[model samples]
Target: MLLMAITVTGASTLTYFVNDSFISGQLSTASSLDTGTKSVQLLAYDTRDSTTLLQVSNLNNKFGDQKLCGVSCSGGGLTDKIPLNGGTEFIMIKIKNNGINSIFLENIKLNNVVHAWDSQTSGIALNTLQDLSSGGSYPHDGTFSIFSESSIIQSTSNEIPNGNTVNLLIKLGSEDDDILLNKGIKVLLNIGNLNPVEFFIDSGGAQ
Candidate 1:
């Protein structure tokens, strides 16, 4: 009976030791990963007129695309009532990333809007507000020296890190065709997978 008891105890010990070794090996080979969310916000919209981003009373409405304010949003559209011309009008869009990840400004596409008759073919440029404040050549004043140094933004390189903001200057014009005239200029600013912030500029006339 003593030998039998000793044999049973030894087997139990051996079983536990093997199980512990297996668990340790399994854990050592295991791998894990984590993920985060990407989000962006259109902080403000600036034009020659007195337009601004305002808060909407109801959160359920989805006709407009404005910056989300917690559970609600502001009405989205050009704040100014009067139409604007592409030549003299420059729309400054302020964008920020308030999410857990960074957002890449992938591209700037124009719908029904053509590039203005300027050296900057894209018609979408980086906002030169800071440069203009210090007498930089942002307005392009039809001078050869000023027109040569246009600050057109390149595609797919602009990065807005978390809590960082960027300003985009948009100036696109309508086609000379009568059908396309006054149809309005639509600017689709793409930032990766997120929905593009849209800007609809009513055409006062061609550039």
Candidate 2:
């Protein structure tokens, strides 16, 4: 079997205030080919607006094909619903295999989520990535910390095998309240093996 691995990672920072709502980030992937030339595509969605926020060319193409070995992002689609009134929200990451064969998802890692609400107000939250099969789905555990100032969120690493497609659902919310599903967050994908591959994103958010 062809062994292909894809991993994503990144960080995001958000500020909090009174009556504030909405915070988001993005997850991206960069792909590379080791042997043959392949076509790869990437797709992202906005669960609220049901829109495709990002659509790019090859994620891992070294021959000016606009392809990449993997992709990374800080934040992509930010909605206007994240509660800014000292709360939390959730972001979802969905990935697919637009190629002809199956790809492996080696692992995923999140640094941490830190908050800077104020000079004396701050906190941190940690989360992990769960694997879903081509047709399987999983919900991101909502474990977010909040403050009256600024803060950050971090995560650890998760792993998976090569397959046709994979989906990552991340839940973002504060320990006090539930975050609105408005903003989008960023995640990075580290893909192993350079094969001619193609990826695409499908969602109701598309035009």
Candidate 3:
């Protein structure tokens, strides 16, 4: 007669705390435009058109859900243009301020063509939310720095102090720039019907 036993386990390295857990796209100001309407309503914790963000927390994406970008994680569906063969990269999002008046953000409209903030190249180019510089030197300076070239995202002081959250940062361009392919980031809110919160960029493809 004989007997034996064995056991093994190892897996615990998932620390994504943007408030200790969040997966709900919330964009408001449409309860019939908040009844009686005085026009001055705009809200978004994760908005990208069609009231996106039913649940998102895997880097950045809630409008259509596509993934593939290696460096930041996920690299395969940014249109699948097949050209960027190198652990690809791209990640930027985390703008908050659930609402209650006190969100005067202004500017941010990338009309696609896949990542194009080439202001002559650098760590982060545009879309403003966050900026890093492992090889360029950027630890914190991404509050939407008024980037232009038709992307129009001015920022003297894009306020957002209700729930608080708006460091703003979006990145991409030159991962072997194979013409990138359909990138997006539009959140031009001045409140109310300031209209402009479109986010539809699915070209994470190739890495």
Candidate 4:
């Protein structure tokens, strides 16, 4: 039996103001492999374009001047094959918040699974969070079962302050065999806060 792993890295630049803050990040392919005897096919995608690249860079420069924090983000897609029959695979996501303030993650949708995590456990469940062909919310935590060949798992954590991090592990497999697979996975980290800060000028009324 042969196993392969893939890794992807991304970062978010933070901008601060009295109101309405902006957090921008990008996703790109890191590495992959062809585990099969013959070569398998692989594909990757990123939403940023020629113009968006410059825009994001400029935004980073602009935010560098203010009192802001940085986030080191990384994630990726995965797939694997079993020997005789097909087995299971898994992908893990680690989110670390090194900022001075707390951050919230809202509406995080991956492949299509949704859940919530915190700085402590980072949202790990005994049973896998699978999709239902009948259509439903899907289980957030606890034991559950599904009968889908493929699934997209995701979890959201809010108010993560400095020195805090979250970890998410996604597993795919059958009852017989399971492999820890991490490949072509996509990750998006939306870092921002909604709290308002007041500032007073030396010789101004409210400007």
Off by over 4 Å in 1: 1-38, 49-88, 110-136, 139-157, 173-187, 199-207
Select the stronger candidate by lDDT from 1 and 3.
1
Per-residue accuracy of model 1 over 1-207 as CA lDDT, tens digit each = 999999999999999999999998777554111111224555554332323311111101111222111111111432211121112233445666676666665555555333222333233343333232333223221111111112334223355577766555443222212212234546665655535556665433211
Residue 77, model 2, lDDT: 29
Sorted on TM-score, highest at the top, how do the candidates line up?
Answer: 1, 2, 4, 3
In lDDT terms, how accurate is model 2? Answer: 0.26
TM-score of each: 0.36, 0.27, 0.23, 0.26
lDDT for every model?
A: 0.38, 0.26, 0.32, 0.24
Which prediction has more favorable lDDT, 1 or 4?
Answer: 1
lDDT of 3 by residue, 1-207 (tens): 122222211112233343234432222335434421232222223323211122322223322333323223224433211112222233334445555666554434433322322232333333212223223211121112322223333333445466554434333333323223344333343333334344443443211
Error of 2 at 146 (Å): 27
Tens digits of per-residue lDDT, candidate 2, 1-207, equal 123222211111223422134322211123323221242234343333221122211111112221111111112322111212111223334455455554433322222232111111112232112121222112222321121112122212232223323333333323212212232223334344543223222221222
- lDDT string for model 4 (21-87, tens) is 3222111111111111011111111111111111111111111112111111111211122111111
Best by lDDT: 1
Clashing pairs in 4: 76-185, 77-183, 77-184, 77-185, 78-183, 88-172, 88-173, 89-172, 103-159
Point out where model 2 deviates above 4 Å: 1-40, 47-88, 108-166, 173-185, 193-207
